[model samples]
Target: MHHDLVDGVPVIWTETPGPLEATLMFGCGLKDETFRTLGVTHLVEHLAMSTLPRLHFDHNASVSLSITDFTCTGRPEQVVDFLARVCAALTALPLERIEQEAGVLAAEGSGVADPVTAELLSIRYGTQGLGLASFNGPGADRIPLDAVRETVARHFHAGNAVLALTGPPPEGLRLPLPPGPRTARAPHPAPRTTRSSWHRADVPGPGLLLSCSLDDQAMLLAAHVLSQRLTDTARHQLGLSYDVDGTAVFVGPGRGERSIQLDVREGQEQRVAELLWHEAVRLATEEPTEAELADEREAAREFLTDPRTADLEVAERAADLLFGETHLDGETKLALQAEVTPAQVREAFAAAMETALLLVPCGVERLTLGRPDGSALPAGGCSERTALPVGSQYRPPLLARARSGAARKVRLVVNADGAWWQDEEGLIHGFPFTEVVGVEVQEGGRMLQGLGNCFVPVASELFAGLGRAIATIDAAVPEALCYPASALRATG
Candidate 1:
């Protein structure tokens, strides 16, 4: 490996047998934006990539949960030209082209991560930071101009970026990004809700999320082994599911979530969910066979021994530098992972299962997924308050309320204090005026998203005569807390 400084940007590279490939990476992604300004990072990436002239070489850029990378593969001159254009674009973005690029982004769609993984993050953290993944936020078109400029100033700079290459820097390569301080996330968003629980969402299958130290190799191996067990039983045996997917996402310097989700056949949701839970429990209790450990270790060996991964290694080192994480070579990681004994795996998984959040698909009849201790896994909720505060009460649309008793019982209250909704089942989703984050200014109404993963839809579509309620909310909340409904987002 070799290192160099190109116009104040740190560059890490290694010679490899291929067309030269280089990635200019910045330590900013979805986790950096507020709920109202979600997609700003992606917008910035699109705007930068849009400025490049047509080229015959293979080149592109992407923004993930933790880093944004602009990459190209061709002659070294192509590499130098691409990096130069990207850095120049970042220092002086073409603001006039935002509208056109936002449309392009909207057409690109919102499938950044697996839907199941995104939902789990939201449940783990609230609707900000990593939680922003699950939400569409204000959509690409609604992202404020000030948010874009602020994001660029705060994150897109020489101090916050690293460049990785498959070979030494090409002559004349220069990264001329503006200078700024390095950025790290505020101490990890405190886990919003208690875990070792379960919930239902509009997902295609069931999945499990466990919070653990990022360095827990035993837990990591257990996750892999458990995934293999599910694939074996769910697909090879019962034929209840097809693919069982797993991923680990970084949330802080030394912590993160490792999750596994499976896609089930219609009518098999309940069975598949039960299998995931039971298999995870089995690993938590019983030690796995020697064969299982050997299988996973051998798989790791096959991947790590390949020569093609030289470019990935360089990029990973760059990300480690960007995030202030300790970077272990592949050999060191493999040795540590291999030393994780079966007993250690059981103990690690058992401890982690206590922090697990099981996700079952929507539309399945309510399931009583029990924990390893035989307790009913509790459901995730926005609030625990039972009673609505004293305030003016608004009922559902008069005609609809008149037709159904349940709709008649629906109550929404907004006053000087705040707003809350009591559903037919009597569960209250409350949002205090002071604790409110952002309010989507919908047509003829406002929707309040608050702390504690709660929201109140004060819209006329659900309740009639909302003019007074809307005025009360607008007068009570800060003007900066509201934005027009996202142009590309269909619902609140």
Candidate 2:
């Protein structure tokens, strides 16, 4: 399902029966108090979700560089009923309450502590008459109830609002039409104008962020190509980071500027920063390898094969559509990606690299790069060496343990599952069938810790649990639990 606001806010919604999921999205070209209002709106969204009765399991929300979305997943039947209630709550949310608005501000402020994240935010934007960080400093949290009320009063104006319903849009769900041509007083537009021009605001933080703008129609196609190439090069080839990806094109006609920014960590900030700059320069000066270009095309094709009924993907795609992105079905992105030549990528890279490069350092007192002025390369080129082959005679077993420290430890095979393990400390751990992949565990050890896998979604939860578990393990023995090869096998 798709709906368009005359004011240019468009929404797309999809519904599926299994494991019900729903997402509410707000597409706005944000600036000034817009982000503050979004912060409040998000808080209200959470409060609204919490108020729903019989809501089970996952309820999440995210505010990104361009869009803010609220999502909830649960039983199908309950979700249908919940959708109506959510719309009602959104329409009726009280933004005039000072206490409520204050709570929202506090929450947004608390989320900004991470150095890496803060740096990303700082560099992706620029301080103009509009200011640097979109959601930065005390003003970000200083929005008053009246300001929020005023913002909300104009927020859901007919042509400026989007309401999407996924998962069996209620048997008889009827959305209320705005009284008239709903339109808000022109708010701030997003920061992208054309493919050739990019804008970013920076604040003090660790690491470096480089942004380059592209022409309008070209930006999306360029991004699809650039993201795939960079990710494959950085992660699969250079082993720079666990992952490297790009943001979907955010600006459109009369929306704002269109740009892409690359983020590098603090420890290797200088080296990575230089590498990124040099790569951009190199790509601009020359063309990508045919293999690199081909790989990007292949990945993009694979990405568009089929859309899972997942709420997050649906919401993102819907938002992209709202922003005037071309809608393609089934591997169209692949064809588009494939059509882009190494020369085109090189040309786009050269054009974008012209944007001003900014640096923000956090946590560290100062940084001294071996090549501070962007000269010199790491001793070895950024190429990854293949992993050493494991001996055929050795097959390691999966190890699970409940550690006493502030780290929640749960070891599971990637794509295979077997038995659950419980430590003497009463911590329950298990590999729930789908965790294992093609890799097999080999040569298990007792005391020594081996870095297995790092998944952000899981790590975030594990660490929280670890913190709590650590406090309880006063004298408990930290057992090293191991699962023999026989213990892991595909389940029927």
Candidate 3:
């Protein structure tokens, strides 16, 4: 591989025989967006691509959790033309067409990760940063014009981008993005939960997420082995599932979230969910055979040594430079994986699972998972208390209480410097007003999103006589932390 610079943008390149494959990467994506401006990154990407003249080439662009890329495979001149047009579009975005592009974006739907995996991120990181992956963010049209300009100024610039090519830089290639210094990203919010547990979501099947070092070779290989085991048992052996998808997204330097999601056959959701947990725990406590480990190593060898993957390797290097990740060449990475023993894989997977989450679909009931200590994995969500704290409390309006006994049991407390609610489920949810990151302003009341994915609703319909609590919140929180709910948001 070789490295150079094109008009101030870092260029990482390599030799390959196929039509030149080029990818221009920027160091920002969904992780950089706010709930109010959730689809802004996609909007920026779309706005750029929309300006490109019709071309007969396999070119496309995408936004992921932490980065975005514009890629194409074509003749050298086509590569040059594509990158130039993309850069020019960014430098002079056609904001007049934002409404047109917003419609396209909403129709395109979410594809960054599968449904189960995306929701798990939200369950782990609240409603911002990586957690934004699960939300549509009001709507694309709601993304402010100022936000677009700021994103371009902050991200799509020479200092924040890298150009990776399957072949050497094409003749006359140029990157004319705006001039700006590389921006540093704040670390993502701390995880909402860090122990063995389970949660339910709208999904086809179940998934397991493990937080670990990005370069943990053993756990990486172990996750691969578990995927194989699940595929073998669930797909081929029991016929309970049709496919198992896996994803590994880096969240910080030397840290990432790895997951395996399986698709359940009809009437088999519960069985598939149980199978996922059983396979994960089984692999953690029992090491895979030497033969099984060899299969994964050989697969790695094929992938790393393939000439067709040269462009991918280069793109990965670009991400490394952008994110400050420790870059290991193909051979070095393989060498590290080769030294990992079965016992090492077992121990690593076991330790990682101690801080893992099992996500099952919402309709599947009676599903149970246990910690290594044999106790049931606690249900995961915002609730940390079974009862409300003593405070000046509010309750449902008389009409609601008279109509529904469950409403009678609900209590909304707003004293002791914060507000909380004990729902009919009898679980308390909320944070101190100071810890509240965002208070989504609704017509009837405010919905607060804060620590541990807690969203407490102080609304007129649910709890009456909240004027004092609302006033207390207004006095305590920064004015900047409050915003009206998105126009496209579902009626609360």
TM-score, structure 2 vs. true: 0.57
Best candidate (score: lDDT): 1
Candidates 1 and 2 compared by TM-score, better number: 1
Off by over 4 Å in 2: 1-17, 29-40, 43-54, 94-97, 104-141, 163-168, 176-243, 254-267, 309-313, 320-330, 356-492
Give a tens-digit lDDT track for model 2, residues 1-492. 455432243445565546656665554323323322324444444444545666566766554444555666766555545655665655676444445544554554544223343334333332211222333322323433555455455554334445454544544443342343433334343332112111122323222222443233333454555555555665577666454444333333433333234454446544544454445455556676788666655664556544553454566566555455555544454555656776777666555544423333333333333332354322211112222112111111222224333222323121112213322333433332232211111232111111111011112222223222222221121221221222212246
Residue ranges of candidate 3 with Cα displaced over 4 Å: 489-492
**Tens digit of lDDT per residue, candidate 1, span 6-62?**
878889999899899999999989888877788899999999999999999999999
RMSD of 2: 19.0
Instruction: Estimate every model's Cα lDDT from 0 to 1.
Output: 0.87, 0.40, 0.85
Measured against the true structure, the TM-scores of the candidates, in listed sequence, are: 0.96, 0.57, 0.92
Clashes of each: 0, 36, 0
- Candidate 3 overall lDDT versus native: 0.85
Best by TM-score: 1
Q: How accurate locally is residue 387 in candidate 3, as Cα lDDT from 0 to 100? A: 76
Give the backbone clash total of model 2.
36
